[model samples]
Target: MRFPRTARLAPPAPAAAGDVLAEAERLHVRLGAREVLRGVDVTARAGEVLALVGPNGAGKSTLLAALAADLRAGAGVVRVHGRPAADWTAPELALRRAVLPQSTALSFPFTVEEVVRMGRAPWAGAAGTDDEAAVAGAMAATEVAEFAARPFSALSGGERARVAFARVLAQHAPLLLLDEPTAALDLRHQELVLRVCRERARAGDAVVVVLHDLGLAAAYAHRVAVLSAGRVAADGPPAEVFTGELLSDVYRQPVEVLAHPRTGAVLVAPRRDP
Candidate 1:
């Protein structure tokens, strides 16, 4: 997977804080005869981590795909970097956004370093690019450098997820769309992943992540979009959106939202019945 260094791609310009990098307005998406997303409106902003959270089959992943322009909008519009999603050529879109799918499967036995290096493929042959630095930085950021030479298929599920994330980081695109990045990780790695998301947002990259863990979303996301039945049930700061009433109803289970005893962070848990 070697890319020529002689080809040049213009990097995306730096984004200002609060700038909307991606947005779906009145969006509708259908897969076969079923509508997976219905009239959803959401935005990913520069310098912010936006988490999409909900119960299973709530359309979190589908909405993420729509934002990434992988799925065509059945109605309304999806915009990336201020232009209609369809307007950007694949190469052009690659320059501005990077996506981490729910799973990463490779038929070939590529090493961790090789996989991470693939992220730089979009910037290949682009002037002033340092592929080595980008790859190394991404691996380090995701804590995957320790296994750089291991075969991708040899790693555990959590390890593979980190490596996949490193690849996305290496792309250095201004917008990031991640699907359940913490799903396979341990407690520590889950925190690590969200910390990296916050770091990216701080550096002015827009991050939209689909999360099933409400606690992580409460802690890391600058804004939370709670999805239910293919629609945005609530969208706002976690403090405002993650009420016990809302969550209990959306999940169809007894749930509770509490403030951390020591740090005042939001904590969500199921209400145990006596």
Candidate 2:
């Protein structure tokens, strides 16, 4: 899980304050008879990682889709870069933001590098020769360079997941929307993915990720938004928002939030039944 120092891109210039990269206000969406998201209001800002955490069926994925502009909201508004998401052309939106869904189904037989190179399509006219560097750097960062020549369909779940992440990294968008980026990874790879998220935020990209792992969310996210029953239960800094009582109530389970003894980082765990 080691990455070469040279593979890391230099941090980009910091974004201006109060610059909202993506925002969803009073967003509502329904699928079939069930309302998936209910009046959810969330904003992702430059240079920050916002982790969306909630139990299953809490509408985390639905909200993420809305933010990515992949799903139309039944009500309210979703804006990216201060403009309505629907107004942006597909190519323009691809350059401004990238999305990694929970799962991808690619029936085409494409090499790993080819799949990663697809991310640069939006910039094909402007990127010139730089696309090679972007693709190589992305593969290196995700530790998928060794599989560049192999067919993407041949890779294992974790390997494919890493390659998929590399595709998003290669996109080089200002805003990133990731849904369950670490779900298919091993423990080490999970940490690696979250570390990549922090690095992206440091590079001035706004990142909003849906994470089921509360501990990972607490450790990496600058802000944590807890969703309960399709509503935002709490939103703030991890240390301030992720309390034992709040998490337990929102998740409808016995959960505990403790401070790490040495690092003072928040630790979340489910309580054992007595």
Candidate 3:
């Protein structure tokens, strides 16, 4: 599949210093008998795309949930906009951040446009809320405007994914926590999703995305955080954190990192032994 030149564009500028938007400090979380996060410290600042990448069960999703205030930390603190996440009322938090879960199962029969408009619920009855405009803009950006009248339950997985993303976009929150936003998308759509993330960051929003594709993380993220065994194994620029040795060690597989000859972008691939 061919990608647009935009895919090769330089990473977005780093967020300004002292502009931390969301953070998890010394956070520990457990689900039933399993501890999902351990003393993890992660931060998302305005104007940056921070990708959380790791092998399965590495706590990337768990950490994102904590940062989104969807899951509580057993210990330590989670803050959004410099205040405790727990302190923000649901409506208040919804106005400041948006979350896209790993899987969205909608059994109810709702039109695509209706589903996207649901994102504006937090702004309901609020002064100066442009519900229709936000929903239309989001659908157009996600390429779901064509199917606005279709039932969300009847759409394909990829289509549903785009619609779901439209909802998050409609929310227009400063902080976006997306879990596997491109998981069900095609090659082009995957790039589209990541490009949207870059666009959001460039517009001064903070994005924290859980990505399994190391290459995507390297290409789009201004900063990459590698999580392993419920802890951050590495955190820094993609070129520095995505070294072959570090990736191979953390992923428990022989992975190779190479630079694109022309673009100088980091490329990640797994080594196959014959």
**lDDT (Cα, tens digit) per residue for candidate 3, span 1-274:** 1112221212123446438999999999999999999899999989889999999999999999999999999999999988999998777788888999987888789899989988877666665557789999999999999989999999999999999999999988889999999999999999999999999998889999999999999999999999999999999889999999999999999998999999999999999888
Residue lDDT tens for model 2, 1-274: 1122222222233466447999999999999999999999999998899999999999999998899889999999999888899998777788788999888779989899998998876665562338788999999999999879999899999999999999999999989999999999999999999999999898888999999999999999999899999999999999999989988898889899888999989999999987
Candidate 2 lands at a TM-score of: 0.93
Count of backbone clashes for each model? Answer: 3, 0, 0
Q: Top model by TM-score, which number? A: 1
| Consecutive 10-residue window with the lowest summed lDDT within model 2 | 1-10
- Which of the predicted structures, 1 or 2, would earn the higher lDDT when compared with the native? 1
lDDT of model number 1:
0.95
Off by over 4 Å in 3: 1-18
Q: Report the lDDT tens digits of candidate 1 across residue range 1-274.
A: 6886644657778999999999999999999999999999999999999999999999999999999999999999999999999999888899899999999999999999999999988887787778899999999988999989999999999999999999999999999999999999999999999999999999999999999999999999999999999999999999999999999999999999999999999999999989
Q: Assess candidate 3 and give its lDDT.
A: 0.90
What are the C-alpha RMSDs, in order, of all predicted structures?
Answer: 1.0, 5.6, 8.0
- The whole-model C-alpha lDDT of candidate 2 against the native structure comes to 0.89
Better of 2 and 3 by lDDT: 3
TM-score of each: 0.98, 0.93, 0.93
